[model samples]
Target: MIEIKNLKKVYNDVTVVDIPHLTIAKGESVGLVGNNGAGKTTLFRMILDLIRPESGEIRSNGEVVAGHENWKTYTASYLDEGFLIDYLTPEEYLYFVGGLHQQNRAQVDETLAALGDFFNGEILNRGKYIRDLSKGNQCKVGVASCLLQNPQLLMLDEPFANIDPSTQFRLKNMLKDANKSKGITTIVSSHDLNHITDVCDRILLMEKGVIIKDIATNSSTLSELEDYFGVGQTLGSVPVAGIDEEENH
Candidate 1:
């Protein structure tokens, strides 16, 4: 389980994330959704201890995540391209991450096999370095490496941002399988509300630096979510109030 209390983060004296309390249970898949600059990424970073929160505490399984001895073994996260090794091939990078977790080459191969066609043959024995791979392919490599460890807590930011539709579907299934079979606690952030609604057990909506809404999928419909997000259409045309015109331009 992951517990967060009075979490806060600031940059240049400006608050970015402020959550009073949150608890994510084991085997649960949660989605964090918000407009750009809503502090979703900041919150995820704090949970992974990649950044220090100005004040508050985060604990995983009753242990403080920042200083826990086994934190790296239990947690795996992929936040951005910086997490990948620029000089290593996809296959080589996976091996490197597995080695850090003390997984043998044979075990790493077995785990890769179980991921099936999620990589779409892009992460195989390619001789090219990770920097040479396309953005989508790089993302696939990062995701595959993280899952190689089969961590108890997994956090991913924009997991499907540049990936193709088929690969995205495969990733969704893989996450579902991990949650069901291993009871992994997963947190994902995405702009695609459909993906979040399809996979997550619960969803948190953020505005600015605060989470304004948290709803369980079992208790809500997609239409309800669209309404909450203020996304709608009028007479087959997207509503101006709901559209992010600036982003589109």
Candidate 2:
């Protein structure tokens, strides 16, 4: 379980994230939805201890996250390409990540073989550095790497942003099956409402750093999200007319 209380972050005198209280139970799949600057990534950073919050605290499996390293044993996160080693080949990177979790090369190779369809023949043994791979392929590598250790808590930010349609569907199915069979506690942020709705059991709509709506995924969830983000309706905050006020002035 993950528990957050009174979490907060500030930059340039603006609150980027402020959550009074929240909890994610074990095996739950959650989707975070928001426009740019809604604090999705920021929140993830705080949870992973990549950034310090001004106040409050987060707990993972009854262990405090901040100033502690125990949670790292069970938590695996992939937020962006920055989380990957661009200088290494995809295979090398996977071995490195697996090593951190005590997974040997042979074990890592076995895991990669099972994900053949997800890789689509473009990732492993390509003999190209991750830096040279296309963004979509790099994303595939990153996503696959996160699943290598079979972490109990997995977090990915915008897993569908840069990928082919066929790969996207395959990835979604992979995540769904992982969640069902292993009951991995999963959290993902995405701008794609349909994809998010399809993979997650719960969705949180964030605006200006606060989750204003929490809806359980169902047949109507996609349309509901579309209506909320539709033009003329606020995506949480920021006056529409004032968008260009700073530039116009």
Candidate 3:
């Protein structure tokens, strides 16, 4: 579980994240949906303690995330290719990541083998460094490595982006099964509302550095998200294509 209090991040005097409080429970799959510059990734980075916040604090499983080392033992995240080592082969990167947890070669191999479906046989033994892999495959490598750590808390930003549809589906199923079987706490941010809603039990909508909506999954949740992101809301100058086709002509 994670707890955040009065969290705020600033850049050049502009407030990018201003979360008063937020809590995610253990074994819960929470999705964050927000448009570009919506502060989702900034919040994640702050949680991982990758970016020092201007104010406030975060605690994971009762461990202070800032200025602490214990939380790393239970946390794993894949935000972007920045998380991957481009020079190393996929296998080499995974092995290196697993070794951080003190897992041996056999353990790492077993974990990769178990994720065969998620990897789709394209990642391992390809004689390709991570930088050489396609962007989608690189994303897979990053995600698979996170899962291999057997993390108690998993953080993935845009897990569906760049992935083909079939692999996207498999990734969702893999995440669901992982949460069901191991009680891993998952935090995912995606622009794809459908994928986020499909895998997450709860959803948070962010805009302008604040979580404007916290919704529990239900039949209507998808539609609600659709409408919010759809045209006619006052989200400032974001044009909706085909909203009025006749006028453009």
Candidate 4:
């Protein structure tokens, strides 16, 4: 339940994000795929009100996000390690985040228990501060913290990066479950085409601060996207497996 109208963000002398209008309905799984400097993270920051848009507005659940606090209660995002409390141990940080949502230590532990597969036994009781963990482990911590909040709207930037393949597969399932079973509105921006296609039903292709193509994913979606990005099988690279193969994983 998010809407953007005339949204634009600029830096110095260059426009980075210039979306005119966009909408994401409740329980929708949307993917944003673009190369570097495509303004995906900028758009996400404006949506979260972490940065003010130069023009236009973003509304969550019909309320202007620019000057509102209500949406914060239902929204959870992890853009980078910057979102983590690096000095705190993983357990301490997660518990602290859970407390912010009024969840007790017991509840936080319960949530962590359910995420054991996602964590792959590296997060809890590690005796290591979040800052000491690898980038992929740090990503796991951030994502786990978000899930502990049980958010209604979840946004992740480049979630598939800096993680192992097994963890990536688990993360995709988690997002799918959140959208289909719990009805969470999910938005993720990623560079990996196969992962994004497997996780999101709809895809937004962005370039030079604008949404160039809004595609409803289908059997041929991956190939079509590859063609646009010039990464087609004709380029002497192995073609990624299709959606059916994604499920098999």
Q: By lDDT, who's the top model here?
A: 4
Residue-level lDDT of model 2, residues 1-249, one tens digit each, is 898888899999999998877778899889999999999999999999999999999999998899998899888888989989999999889999999889999999999999999898999877999999998998988888889878999999998999999999998998898788889989999999999999999887889988776667777778778988886353333222101233222
lDDT of 3 by residue, 65-115 (tens): 999998898888999999998999998898899898899999999988888
Q: Write the candidate numbers in order of decreasing lDDT.
A: 4, 2, 3, 1
Clashes of each: 0, 0, 0, 0
lDDT of 4 by residue, 52-158 (tens): 98899999999999988999999999999999999999999998999999999999989999999999999888799999999999999999988999999999999
TM-scores, all candidates, are: 0.89, 0.92, 0.91, 0.92
TM-score of structure candidate 3: 0.91
In model 3, residue pairs whose N, Cα or C atoms come closer than 3 Å (at least 3 residues apart or on different chains), thus clashing, are: none
Clashing pairs in 4: none
Give the runs in model 4 whose Cα sits over 4 Å from its true position: 231-249
List the candidate 1 regions with Cα displacement exceeding 4 Å. Answer: 231-249
lDDT of 1 by residue, 69-151 (tens): 66777888888889999898887888899998899899999988976688777778768999999989888888888788779
Error of 1 at 169 (Å): 0.7
Displacement of residue 130 (Cα, Å) in model 3 is: 0.7
The count of backbone overlaps in candidate 4 is: 0
Give the C-alpha lDDT of model 1.
0.81
